[model samples]
Target: MARTLKEATLTTRNARAKLGEGLHWRGIDADTHLGYRKGKRGGVWLVRWRVAEGHYHRDKLGAADDAITEGTLDFNAAVRAARERVEAVRREERAKADGVVHSVRSAVLAYSEMRDARLRERTGSEALRTASSSALERYVTGRVAGGNMEAREAAPIADVPLHDLTEAQLSEWRDALPPTLKASTRRHISADLRAALNMAYRLHRTKLPASFPMTVTEGLHISRKASAEAGEATARENQILPDSKIGEIITAARDVDAAGSWGGDLYRMIIVLAATGARFSQVARLTVRDVQADRSRLMVPASRKGQGSKPEATPVPVGADVLAALAPAIRGRAGGDLLLTRPKMMREPGQLKWVAVGQRPWGMAARLVEPWAEIRKAANLADDVVPYALRHSSIVRGIRAGLPLRLVAALHDTSIAMIERHYGRWIADGLDDLAAAAVVPLVPA
Candidate 1:
């Protein structure tokens, strides 16, 4: 027996309530249907369309007009809205099949592809491109680790048609983001999405529908209060170590390598990190070719800056000790090998070995914490000290040594504004020079 969906009366509040709790769908045409799902509070409208033979896609339209509420639709309105939605879906399906885009997911994917292509051309390393993939998966197309815990059942917003996207829908997505994520992390994800959507709109404007919400500018950020809180937390957390203490940590790392615990892998990496002041991720992405051992410089990759092969990568001049530590690894490995690798043997075994026999890239940050703790304890440093202290201390050292803020920013792959914002306290180290210059030829007066 075949269940036939007849034309049902969903006009009045009484009529909808009688249709019952489950979805009551009525065929509007051979290919489209208008649906109403009864609920305790109110009923809701839904629409489904057969884009292919025997294959249908469904989407919620809005609330059914059981009451006089904003956006609640009457029978006629529901019919119009449902047909519009069905048409939008069918149009996008045709366009998508033909390699065109009108939906949010399609726009985001297009932007990502272009961005990765640019990154590949600029850096000649796929690390940035790889990072973009991870971000898109974690935050956009997929969900985060601790996604909106309450509403875990919400449909992924990735497929929301740009024609259907509204401020409320986007804001709903933002509010539904994982509450556990740091404000800064949330902000970054939001900014990345906004940038992607905006980029797509600029590059493919003609492909977009009239209802395509210009760019993703509405409600796509953490609040200013949240941003301020994150800034305060960053300032509180990042501790700067002096050169003497950094030197002690290096020596302690060497001792750990001698004990066969780290096998000199971490030891060499620490040297490069302390010497170059690059982010852990940036340094970890370094290839054997990046090591200009002959010139005692390392071509550290800048993080997501400088498009199109222009930003020179600014070879960082390192000390003799850094060169000496690197020479052993540089001598044997090919130019494409990772400059740093996870150490072999047991740092305490019984764990699954992530590092392969031939390929050993740096593992997770949490795993590195234990190894760094050993060196921190050995150097008699505070428990709070971590690998990032190397970068912070280096930045601080440059500031205290009266290096121009611009130069320091360029060297660290950060902005001058960041230096001024986070490490402004250290910039006062130039007060003595300022005071001396202020005195000038006052004796003549």
Candidate 2:
């Protein structure tokens, strides 16, 4: 049966517990069949409207009843509120349909497209452009596309109806993520999702009904270091190797021959990592020109994870061990320009073959450290030894040696705040020792 105010009036009388429900029904006008909305908790208001044929137009008005209850809206008032909602919905739908038509998977994809265009304008490398496109594709597929799939399987995350979803719904979705993922990882995903929404809101692509339920700043998990008994450890704990073990590894490294084909340059790389707190990627990208023997500094020209495209030089002092390790490899390097070089494998009939090192410094650190770890295993060293252990060892020793955090960080080409945050235990121990030493017995007692 076609719903009308007459039909709804009867239902309203019977539905005494919910006067709003009865008014919700009564608000509908069958002649101009449109839609109904009911809410009285805040203030009683109802809307009903019909879209005018073949045009984007709606007419509406407000009800005069101050104490609106189970009674229906006057015809004019019903028409007015109905018209406004219908118009608002139409605009929202049009915008959404436009995005669908444009095939925008996520705001990241759109932003990436704009970024690429800017890069192209700047005459950036074709290879870099290709990599950026690949990055965007991967990000979209892994996050946005994956979220959509989850939603289809009743694990809706990305496609959440923002208007309808409550804070509880968002919290449940966050909880449903893989428990194995580190809390940091969960925070990252939440941040990325929030970014997508924020971008959409900015572009008028979609409305975020409220502030994001997950905030990066507050009330999120800060992963605690695992207890020794629990067999879990923080990244900091795992990254620290004893200085004695580092010495042993270096000694073992000195004996290992460059397996006839592969170079022994790996030893030098290991020594550099141990001496300076230079990250793996920074070590890999080291060019001969980046070294300043006169100034006794190694200029790091790039960072793997940072804001800028071309990194500024970070001056790190070259230690005696680092210099000694680098000398033999630098002398015999296949490429005159490269700090670490690979020998030419083959030459085509008419083409010149030349020795070169890969500029893309990816796994150089890992490759170099693996051999020392193997040596450690052979010599029965502790199981906690890792490539990054060298870095942690340097920081811990520097703090123990009473090196100021500022100078230590400058030596390592990193922020003092970072060193203090991650390796503050070493400094705290020194303070404790100093405090104990200061406690002398009273002479006159």
Candidate 3:
């Protein structure tokens, strides 16, 4: 028997209260119906309508007659609200299908694709592309380490709808980032996300809300604070080892080598790092040909910062003593042989093998080893002394030795601006030379 409109429309509370839990005919549309379920407040009315074949979208219309005895909801009004909700959902689904920026995840994906296309076309530098890709990865899959402990377990908001994203939610995510990350790094990541959002709006040509990242600038207060803190920390903690400290570390490295722990390789490696101001990656990739050709200069291959098809043969003037120290490795080795190889270590059951120092487990040749923890402990150096500190020490030593800032920057394959920014205070010590050279006794006026 078919339920009629009169049968479904119960005007009084007492009459509708008799209807039990399950789908009840609304007699409004073929797909529209009222679902009744028991709730804390007696019974609840759920307005459900089929948006597609075998797929229904439902919303809570209001409490049933038993719960809403004072002010009962009319059947006609409830049906109208249900229809409106279904239409809204249909619009959202259609927008999503049409790629009109529905969700944050979708927007990020689209932006990433655009970025990759740009990278493929060589529209941007590799470094910029790499940084942007890293930022995007962190954004989609929340950063695991290097942030505040409280924020370590926060859920990724990649699935969040773009329109539904609130400032409070974004703030929470930003606050949860690793407290250890530099302020500049935090700022960069934020900028990347903002760019992605902007790209989404532009690509989709959708009318974004005024609260979008491009329109809003003041909400990222925590990220800005973190950036400030990082800057302060960098200034305070930039450790450039003194000459005496460098000598002490060298002596410690020699002692470790003499103990047969790993022979004199570490000592030589340290000497090369300090002498040339070359990065660990650059030094590790050197061949016998690089060392044998020039006693005064160590040729650095195309590094992360280097721009060219061929390797950069940087002229870093080294003393004969440094060359003498490296001679043992260069002797009787082919030009193609690695200048520095890992010490022979017992693998399993008396199988001793020498591994390439630059060999990465993942087969990436460009990875640099920072064996600072063990070396620092052996050298009795400060905990803050990192591998890059050797390069800083070298730059400082050159500046203090009265080497021109331009020459030092050239030797290190960097800019005068970078040198000044990082080691400007040390460079100031050599200004007296400039002052002395500039001073000329004035003729009788």
Best by lDDT: 1
Once model 3 is optimally superposed onto the true structure by TM-score, how far is the C-alpha of residue 59 displaced, in angstroms? 22
Model 1 vs truth, CA RMSD: 10.7
Q: Which lDDT tens digits does candidate 2 get at residues 252-329?
A: 665553532335555666677777767765676677776666787778654644333543767877776576667765
Which residue runs does candidate 2 get wrong by more than 4 Å?
1-44, 47-155, 158-171, 184-232, 235-239, 301-311, 328-338, 341-373, 410-421, 436-445
Model 1 alpha-carbon miss at residue 128, Å: 15
What C-alpha lDDT, on a 0 to 100 scale, does residue 386 get in candidate 1? 75
What is the alpha-carbon lDDT of model 1 when measured against the actual structure?
Answer: 0.73
Clashing residue pairs, backbone N/CA/C < 3 A, model 2: 48-82, 60-79, 60-80, 61-80
lDDT of 3 by residue, 183-215 (tens): 777766666666676667665544445446533
* Clashing residue pairs for model 1: none
Clashing pairs in 3: 146-178, 147-177, 147-178, 147-179, 148-178, 148-179, 183-227
Given candidate 1, what's the lDDT at residue 442?
53
Please give the range of 10 consecutive residues that has the lowest summed lDDT in model 3. 359-368
Better of 1 and 2 by lDDT: 1
Score each candidate by Cα lDDT: 0.73, 0.53, 0.63
- How many collisions per candidate? 0, 4, 7
Candidate 1 residue-wise lDDT, 104-213, digit = tens: 67766777888777656534446555456456656667643464433223236788766456667677777777888778777767777777777666665555555444
lDDT of 2 at 258: 53
